[model samples]
Target: MTHRPLPRPLNFAAVFLAAALTVELLDELVDGATGAAWPLVRQDLSLSYVELGLLLGLPGILVNLVEPFLGLLADLGYRRALILGGGVLFAASLALFAVAGGFWPLLAALVLFYPASGAFVSLTQAALMDAEPARREQNMASWALAGSVGNVVGPLLIGLAVTLGLGWRAVFALLAVSTVVALIGVRKSPSLSQEAPTGEKLDWRDAARGVVAALRRGEVRASLALLECANLTGDVFRSFVALYFVDAVGATPAAAGLAVAVLTGVGLVGDVLVLPLLERVPGVRYLRASAWVTAIVFPAFLLIPHLGAKLALLGLLGMLNSGWYAVLQARLYASLPERSGTVMALGSVAGMVSGAVLLGLGAIAQHFGVEAALWLLLAGPLALLVGLPRRASLGSR
Candidate 1:
């Protein structure tokens, strides 16, 4: 029998970009809005900084726990269902968050929301990978760019909404509408059907074994460790940067929101500019240079005391930081065989674990000061350097 080549990867960039933007809108509505309103929320709710951190961190914990199961389901050929279902659940969570009156209600909503987000993210990447296995690097770069665009747009939109006196609840409502629209976009896209078939049923135990086997490989392990470090740094900044601006830099809520918007917007630009250049550069060399740049720029946030100087530093940080995800993700895809869903899910799990640890550290640093928290950010790049071997042979093409 003559074998036909697979269809070229679906040009789901528009769908993916729309969905990613919606997801970011929801995320910013919940986290970014809350961060900007931290002072007001703390005063109104009579909550401590530690409690706020816990509330924010809960999503990470829930998402990590549920991701492996979602990944298993995707591998079992339910990619479309998982993606669509996640979108629905994410929308509902945002609605719940908008009306949530107390801490418990907010926490419950987050628990529902984040797992769905994780599922959607994993399945979306899997779908893209299935569509164009040969062009995995380019596609993954595009995927990262979509996320960067979302991050940029989400914060700026929410900031505008808040500035217009729409309040945080209104922001959530807008985000819910955006998610529904994105869901429609996703449904219109062609269904993906390139996953490996599971001849017999496989349990979580089987999946766990697969994960263990993958991690046991030396190069894969190194890559995972490096990714964990990157994740920790990113999560730490995302979770606390707004608070730092408000409390440490003496900025108002609107100003803090603008700072975040600027960072994300510049980062989006960086992703678009960097994607085309990846092919011309050696992946290993690019990773090394990006890592060093991140390491240097991240700590500089500590020294810049003036608001304008800090914003400038953040833009530079955004430029360097934005490319890291695409580079790392491309390397990750190159390292794995065909288990894109499984690999991406496992990577998410690693990132969540790192997020939880970083949040704990953030809580501790909150007691001391944001300065100490900045120090914690330094640990990530240092860890990345230590975990990654000096030799470049370990990374896959």
Candidate 2:
């Protein structure tokens, strides 16, 4: 009897990729849940507006100072320690959030969670890239897909908690448990121990210099620019889409909220669809085409008077740009091969600069109106058009 060969068990590499992608998903899930739960948290803690602002902004700024060094440390052969240790701290921080009595305690937990996420979640991403160098773009598409799922699931979890009359604390407590489960998966994964050689060990100072050298390179600088610019059409656009619907389109708050949902929900569908598309299309070629199409569609989205038409354009824009980050980031890693950790370090520094740009955009919005400010997002696809290499295809690995 020619029985089908027994279904093969997952090999080490496959198991490791699963664990790493789970971490990415969990990371975004926590972020989505936390953002959704914040109003409840603020009411429970009786937080002041200033405190809310601090909670939103302070931890990110503080973590930036340390995450770059953490990235350097990962390159210095501390990836496993950073990821596992950070996972423990991440769970503890969530537990802290579950029980925070006031703003200060909650702030402390936020402070801890940011860098811990950098260590556990971001390093897991780096590890995944190292695990399969030839398949970086493909693997990143999967990672991005996992994150998209997490983002969708997170808000749903909060909604479920609210429906059941369970408090936000319960949601956080559950997340902490999930974090532990993901940590165990990472800890058991054999691939965490393996790293591409990074030459002789250098002290943190030397590693910092290495990051500086990478920034000096034209390709690295361009990659950083592309990443930040891409955010304009991505997270930056999501942040303001609801407001745009309200202020620009004269939509009610309920309808505005639906705008946000459509943006994210459609983006999630795009992420799912992009995985198969990437197998057939070269990443760069697809990005170049996406950029040109988005450049046209975004302006139309702004000019179109009809709300339905605008929504259609927005969904098309989201779908068109689905593989943007996956492809761009894989190219960034390819540009600085064997230095995935350094890529992280560079990303952190670039992030700080990009964070300031958001403020500038906000200032422009306040002065010129959101629609005018959103025009700046045109820079995203335009940047891609300008910066992407002229080559038609990178050819499959």
Candidate 3:
């Protein structure tokens, strides 16, 4: 007898994914605007590189500390309030961000905005994973794809902001408006408990033990290390690329915006292309090979003196870098399939160190150049080469 495929379930997986994507798109637009307008912001505020890095990073400390707790709460079934309430707060924060005029207010806004949005990011991933466990890899890829779409809109939004004389604040304003609409849909949607019903109440003791246990797993260790490396490199690039375009290459702000757009736009394509291969190929192989390729292309991208040449190389680099997260994150979930909530919070924990990295990069840029600071990104591939498991499958275990 021939095997017949089971029918796909009618659930809010699609709805939740849409809400998640909307949040991502809105967040990236602001991110793109900030990066694209960095030089302008810097000049306007008469800020130093150290100040800028601190401005961008110091507010993240509180968020990082509470992240695991938030994850644990989500695992305990707070997805509805976390998603809906957090999104509205996230939107309000963005709207507040528009009115922030000086360094302190700006810092406050970052503090409020990141954690607020962090809620959406962490919970949505948990909910979506809960909603469809079997399709973890595909769902992770879809998540990235959605973020990539946001990435594209980000620079384009900034580019339009510059063209229309709307200024950087406009990006935040638009994101706030868009986020309100997204939250409305999110609020109306069925609770995640409807699919993955509430579990036992969160036990901090159990969570602490689970974390210790997770840390001991060689697979978890490897994946988290790779994630840390990936986050560093990607963060450095995102924070610096627009500055590189305008500061080093003398590109216009609009041109810088487009350059960021191109970098992420190519990444979007790469993510879409890999969704199918993810099922057929060993994720580690792709992750490893992509790492080597990105490492190779990255320096050449720096060496090339021409602005156009660098942009072309960045697109190639974007394509290579795009595969790291999907495959690595999939492998991550596969490592401890039950702890999607935990995996969502690991980045924030790792992010605790990123401020220091950004500070060092800022120092380097102040003393030498942004390109010299960017050289630090080599740590990403180096970590992959040493830490990522050599197993034939996605997870070494």
lDDT (0 to 1) per candidate: 0.68, 0.87, 0.73
Ranking by TM-score: 2, 3, 1
**Candidate 3 wrongly placed segments (more than 4 Å):** 1-12, 36-55, 99-107, 159-171, 188-191, 194-200, 242-261, 302-309, 364-376, 390-397
- How many clashes (backbone atoms < 3 Å, residues ≥3 apart in a chain or on different chains) does model 1 have? 1
Which structure among the candidates has the greatest TM-score?
Answer: 2
TM-score of each: 0.77, 0.95, 0.80
Error of 3 at 383 (Å): 3.3
Q: Which segments of candidate 2 are over 4 A away from where they belong? A: 1-9, 194-199, 392-397
Task: Output the TM-score of candidate 3.
Answer: 0.80
Residue-level lDDT of model 2, residues 90-188, one tens digit each, is 999999999999999999999999999999998899888877877788889999999989888998999999999997899999989999998988998
* Tens-digit lDDT string for candidate 1 (1-397): 9977554332455455445444444554455555555555566567777878878766776677778777767766677888889889888988887787777777887888888776665676667665555555555666777666555555555568768987667777767777787778776666444445456666667666777787788767766777767765565676677888988889999988878777777877877877776667555566667678778887787777888888988888777765566556656666765566677567766776675676687687769887677677777777766665554442324
After best superposition, candidate 3 residue 238: deviation in angstroms? 3.8
Q: In model 1, what is the error at residue 287, expressed in angstroms?
A: 2.0
